[model samples]
Target: MANIYKILQELPNLSFEEIFLLQEKVTKEADFRSKELLKDVENTILACPQCGSKDFIKWCKYKETQRFKCKDCNSTFLPTTGSSVHWLKKPKLFLRFCVSMFSGNVCSLKTQSKEFGISPSTAFEWRHKALIALGQESPIFQGVTEMDDIWFRYSQKGRKGLKYSRKRGRSSHKGDNDFVSKVLMSKERGGELDISLIKIGRLDKSSIEQRLSGKFADTSVLVSDKHPSILSFAKSENLKHETFKSEQHGKKDIHVQTVNNLAASFKADVNHVLRGVSTKYLQNYANWFGVKEKYKGLKDKVKTIIKDCFSNNKAWDMFMNTELLYKDFILKKSKRTYRCPTVRYRKHQNWNFENAKRGTYI
Candidate 1:
């Protein structure tokens, strides 16, 4: 640090072109450190990430990354399996990309891509992939929790061959059209919050219970506006509850200002900063927002963020399964909602290689 400080002491004497050149060189040097960061990426996991079984063995190496085989599930896996960083063709840049993504100032896809020397398309995919798993690390709701429901208009932002006009922002139509995206925000007193995509249209008891059941503590008091769904949910769960009128919205300390502010900020980022995104991917964005908010005021978070991102298995399939979630959450609930292609593929794959080697099978 002192050496860098001394080096910076000469910066005042540099001309405009010299400063510009020096900045370009510095950026390259900084970005190069991500490759160095790869050495610190060790497979510290003992249990199988897929089935949580500790009875596993190192199978083999594939493309220089170690692979593991679970005896229980008889499945092969990688350290980064089901992670946001999984299947990365250029993993050397992953740490650098993550740094830029979680750097407190969320940048545009173009900006992030330009900084990392990848296309905006890759950046978009990486961002959502990370969000899918990050959304899983929500805070537990307890005590005097403030709750509210926020809505976004139905949007097929990037879908092709759309038969109707693209929906943006909240619906102007007066009643529920079964097209709005409902995000339920529950914030605890000390700021650990749970922002979740509960359902598609009108917020109701069953949907809220599905997302938040057993999440609240036994003694937790639920506070919210006089929304019938919330009221019903509280009664069904036997939780202590409180309500606020429109006139008493923010006059008292019991206000839902925390979640309200959170909703506004998230809406700003989604509806304005990104110029809107598809409702199919809105849950991912909610997860992204929750993670960023969770990391605020933390002293050290890079390791925490990386761990959370890789905590789940088959997250890539889940990200790809958003269409299914959209259909199930908004449209009809399918019998195959939980069966992603990855699982289905494994079901049909041959596990016994010895027979093939002995010419018993091709």
Candidate 2:
């Protein structure tokens, strides 16, 4: 039995085929008594978030669906209750498989449904819920942050037409003229990033200011290109801001390049794997991609994270801590400092954004 447990822990990075192999192996070797014993020891202690009741029992009357019922609260719900998975129909095991498949840009939801014996709608629900949960999991990136914007077309290939073609009958229109604005922000040290959706307009003073209002009220410095939007906002707010407008300095450490590369990789993956996602869910998908990147290859990272999330399961508390994480990381470190074309915009500038500069000084 101990050997069986050890073997289960050592299961390889699971593929669709590998999952079947494990299913077969586990089923053949796992007697009802052994399975019951394992469940009794491991799964017997889930708590109800709403009522804080431990008097709960696993009731899987439907065979395919798993739910927990609490005698104390007289409530029954699936594993997704109060979670991003609240309304999902895919099994929990399959949901984990979907997360693993997100290693690259696109996931074939149709193929996944067929392969896993789940309905397409169920697969879609799992994908959507997983992506949203990923967004909910991004750590508030802190320490010397950098931000910039990049443009993206909706389709992989631009509309069917030559760039210089001059056809009289409705010349050419790129696939639906859809575009996306990517606001890419990253922290120093570990390259942890906070990627967000933006309107299809100039990433200007108001844009920077709005994002800063929530996260940068306590920021130190901000860095960017010679873009006036970032520069003027820093000036108006009396926050330290710098730029890398020169050729040599741009070669050394430009956040624009960093952000572009990140966006490009994301675009490439989306194009190849997921094909193209709907714009409505783009933010959620992008956030999911960002969190995966941030936590890539940390041994047992997902398992550890899920354990912590379950241990501290309060919605309000989770939101409060999430805000703090964002403020400390994303808000404060916009113009991260290195030393190429150095500019120290702090020290002399006042920290207040609303008040007059003199109000804080003389």
Candidate 3:
């Protein structure tokens, strides 16, 4: 300690010009270190995204980014090309944005835009791009799994020519006003979860069966509410099924409370955190929640998200595909609402009671 103190004391004090030079040198060293970290990320790119060729050669440099040439295709590409952040305007701010995302704070696009000085639209795009990486599907559920469907009303926000109704809750199933969208959720006990926004016209036995086929093993047990469609699904699939009446709550070993709780939490997140997200992006929001639930206890979630983001080539493709717009949220015609025959049958049965109440029955 005395020798170190003596060495420090013997060093000459720097003049203002010398201090400025030293500061510049330190800043350059810091910049170099940051570049080294980013280069490590770039090293993960092996094959050419265009031709799937492993042959790579140093093509050129552009604005401190290394460019590569594919030997087979003779195409040039940047290291960031075909990746999730491929046309990112400010690469240096990416880490900061990611840090904010994983910081367990309420990070809306508006909030992020204000904090990072980026346009709200850019923040929205970047946020979804990152979420697309996290939205990869999990392996099928196994063991005792709980399954249920959650419904969200179709939103007509920001749309023209739609009559604005003051109804703020689930609508009566009597008319077109009762239109609702569905999302199927399944969770394996102590395992992964699967949540998919259903694009089917009806949540009938046939639709449930189709979605459940090949998703469960023969040894798996299914637990769900007393929906007749679900009951029929269990019978046809020949899997052991447990049915619970949701109205009869607090029952042990017979309820789909796990998946129900998951649905509740998911809805809460959509309502509170995202502040009532549009139905167009609800699937992505659900997927983001699923991934968050999957990686709940991880200590280094930021690193994990970044690793997954880079490893997901499909997400990169989806991000780059400009034709895939948010307006095209419904992938198929099946998403359109159709009147349920069961509801029509019930309404017909209720006609007699209405006529009797009105003293119009002969």
Candidate 4:
């Protein structure tokens, strides 16, 4: 078996080839480790923000910046500076855990915390920041577009109290309700569904007109699931609009079933990992899944996925600081403990700082 101790030690300094060989050297090492090692390699190339210089002193490590100082500028920076983990308590493991969760390996907050040797709250914070960063990275869909909405319900058994009981199981926010109305927007040819959630009140004609303007040319075709609201807007814009019967939702060449299946799988996976996440933050989690699901089925598996995510150096830099990204919190009112904040917002909720600190974002 490979000596994980030796691999972990060398992992900080090893190149991708060396890391791969070390993992390969240990016959029983999980293939996942090799991917993690590669991610570590890519993580090291943080150029100097001041000078854009990759010439850094690799030996001088700071607690904040995992890498050494930039010799050219005499400045120090973390590998993910300007990225989401810059202010992180545990930068190295934070990135690793993120890759782990995205790869469907370490799937839960509890599991990730234990594996990475972090407090549950710390793990939760890392996960959340990673998610916010990932969502920010999703490409803006700008071709022929389709739009629709679906309703997802959340149980309120353990929520605040009987006072808001009526509103409990229903959506917790306006955006979420709008998500129901604008769920599946794009059903393109050859089985691709481009989905986006619009804010509440943004579902009307003026909203669509504003959002869709310049998104497509005057002559582009739009498809939907025959929602009257969607059709009405299509007619108003004088754009080509086609509606499919419910049975024909994913029929052959005209089907968006593949994307729907993907979305369903994503929802189930997230719901399972979060285990009763408040409805308010559902869309943020949904957005997280969208970014992850985009780069599907690479030939090299996990390694390629990690590389691609970290390759956008500038984007990565901007998202490294946790404090700069997420500013809200979710609190379990009954327990008086802070829950992790969701992308959505809720009013009059209470929180436990200790528990709030431990939410997974990505």
Candidate 5:
């Protein structure tokens, strides 16, 4: 305190440019002092994120916050720059959000918006962003892996034509001409789980192979239901495959019960906790489910989430590239069935002069 007071006492006698220079020097010294104070407390070493150099010096301060300059790149940056939350405002709120998600607190976007005093859009974006980070961090599936496909209804919530369909509850059976979304899931018993929501039209052998290629080790035994796609995938990959009719009991070393149970739990979570997620963002929700299941048993899950939030820069890039456009969210004609007859629909179309001007008819 006396040294700071002496420095303050000498500052008033300096000119404007000299005062600026002195301020920079004081900031550097303060950074050194802070490093000295924290040397024994924090052992985590921080290197230059850009150049990967440790040869950096304190450059400036912003309201008592010290910034560093990389000697190799001659670039200045805050510690949070290049991190997942680099562009995030209200970081404390985001931390709290992470804790809530990690602790399995079932909070909706509306609830989060109210609690955090942010808009629902912001809450939705933040949730997906965190899910992206956690999804990228999901461990690889290995050992006795159980793989299966689960289905969710193609939903277009908060959009027109929702009233035409049944509100809430599962979609009609798969063969009923109802739109269904497919999710491929793999679980290593007592290990990691992977869930991938397929955006492509159907869940065929090719789609499964494309999405899950290189996911499992050749030596890892895969247990699955007798679905033809799964069987074909297992055969094509040359993996040791075991299959059972989904309803049949396991004979000895063959069953997809692990992934089956995981699928059931994941569906229940989406149905009850999330109150149904939109089909467009369903992949992100599935990712979140995988991450939640992955980290559920860890004692330091919160710490792990926070650490990943800072370190997973690629996750941020993934989140940025994930499109939330209306076109992507809307159900396609291939996934939907027209209720009315085509002739009758065309006859009843509201064609007008405006439609002619637009060179189209409804």
Candidate 6:
């Protein structure tokens, strides 16, 4: 406080040009800071982030913030220990980055990178960190859950080490399961949403169960197009099921139109706006989509997303772990057999296209 006052007192001694520059700097700082998480987040963080215990106490100050020792977990942690900003080098950039990330407007990584003066990789990483953190708050589907499957052409947009030309162009045409990535989108009537990337090359009962088994409430009614996988999932979960043919959506009250629209918009953002993303980061983008939908029409969308980035501790672990496991998944199980760049498949593949369908010939 004293330092701020002292600095202010010196402003009168500066030339008009210097004063103008100073004002510009201050305004920019204020703009970014307004979007930053407030220090009062400490009050809301009454429990230990690790063990969810309320008995933690401030043990010390580190990096200008309070660090506490959890009584139950016997672990030391900062308020943001489990959050996206936990390991961030530049905390000031969080909310500013989120404005571009969670906004209704589309921002490509390159554009964000240029705008924010960050590398494209840093932009990508930061975007996913915020997304994966927010994904921790999965909605519990209660009543009238609309469900549907949306597919993206298989992509390994950022993968390396290919010796042959990658697959490119329109795929998923005429049921090309071998080159498509499957995603399951579900939304309850109350606006609770779940959009998950199931896998490459098929929407199956097992995949739907993996994303939605425990998400639906006991009394929740499942609605969808008559995809056998959806029916099988509803049966397996013992959920009250209602479905219609894709063409018969509006004829009766039964429809999955809510989630269907969500899927289309999400696909536009992922495939068109961002010009397509890598298969590995598809789930992160899905979570990002959830962030937008969850807070749509709400004020302080950036503020809410910033708090979310600080709230979820487990998401950081999962995001990093998934990166570690990506090698094996892309190599052995990605179903990107033909032009895959992960391992030598006895197939020569020259890879290109930042937006390829597994980077194959379209």
lDDT (10s digit) by residue, model 1, range 33-102 = 5433433343456676556699999898876667789999998987776555766777657666776677
Off by over 4 Å in 5: 1-79, 82-84, 137-140, 159-178, 324-362
- Which segments of model 3 are wrong by more than 4 Å? 1-48, 51-80, 158-178, 204-212, 232-238, 247-250, 320-362
Residue range 1-362, candidate 2, lDDT tens digits: 48968877777767889889879886766445333332332352467755668888877644444667888988886544544333334435543554455544456777878767778866765565455444432234345556666554322121233344323322144432323334445444355676665433345576555455435434445667776776787688775665786564556554466666777777776655666654335555676667667777776555433432222233222222332332232233322211122112433222222221111100
What lDDT score goes with residue 351 in model 1? Answer: 29
Prediction 2 TM-score vs. true: 0.56
Candidate 4: count of backbone clashes, pairs at least 3 residues apart or interchain: 33
> What is the lDDT of every predicted structure here?
0.69, 0.50, 0.65, 0.50, 0.64, 0.70
Evaluated at residue 345, the lDDT of candidate 2 is 41
Error of 1 at 58 (Å): 4.9
Candidate 1: misplaced stretches above 4 Å? 1-46, 50-52, 58-67, 74-76, 165-172, 333-362
Q: After superposition, how far is residue 207 of candidate 2 from its true place, in Å?
A: 3.4
Model 5 local distance difference test score:
0.64
List model 6 lDDT by residue over 1-362, tens digit each.
Answer: 47989998998899989999989999888865653454645556777765568898888888677778988889898777756676677877766677666764767778889988999878877877777666543468888888877888777776676665556667636684667777777889876887777667766787676556688878788888788878888888888998776678687779876877888888899878888888777877887788778888787876777676666655555545444345444554456654433432213222222212221111
Clashes of 2: 8
lDDT of 4 by residue, 39-111 (tens): 5744657566546677876655554334557789887665555455444556556556766777773266678
Give each model a TM-score.
0.78, 0.56, 0.69, 0.56, 0.67, 0.78
Relative to the true structure, candidate 5 has a C-alpha RMSD (angstroms) of 14.5
Instruction: Put down candidate 3 lDDT per residue, 158-216, tens digits, no spaces.
Output: 33334444355555564323356667888998987888665433466765654566678
Candidates 3 and 5, the one with greater lDDT:
3
Q: CA lDDT of 265 in candidate 3? A: 86
Displacement of residue 52 (Cα, Å) in model 1 is 4.4
Provide the lDDT at 3 for model 6: 91
* Alpha-carbon deviation at 284 in model 1, angstroms: 1.0
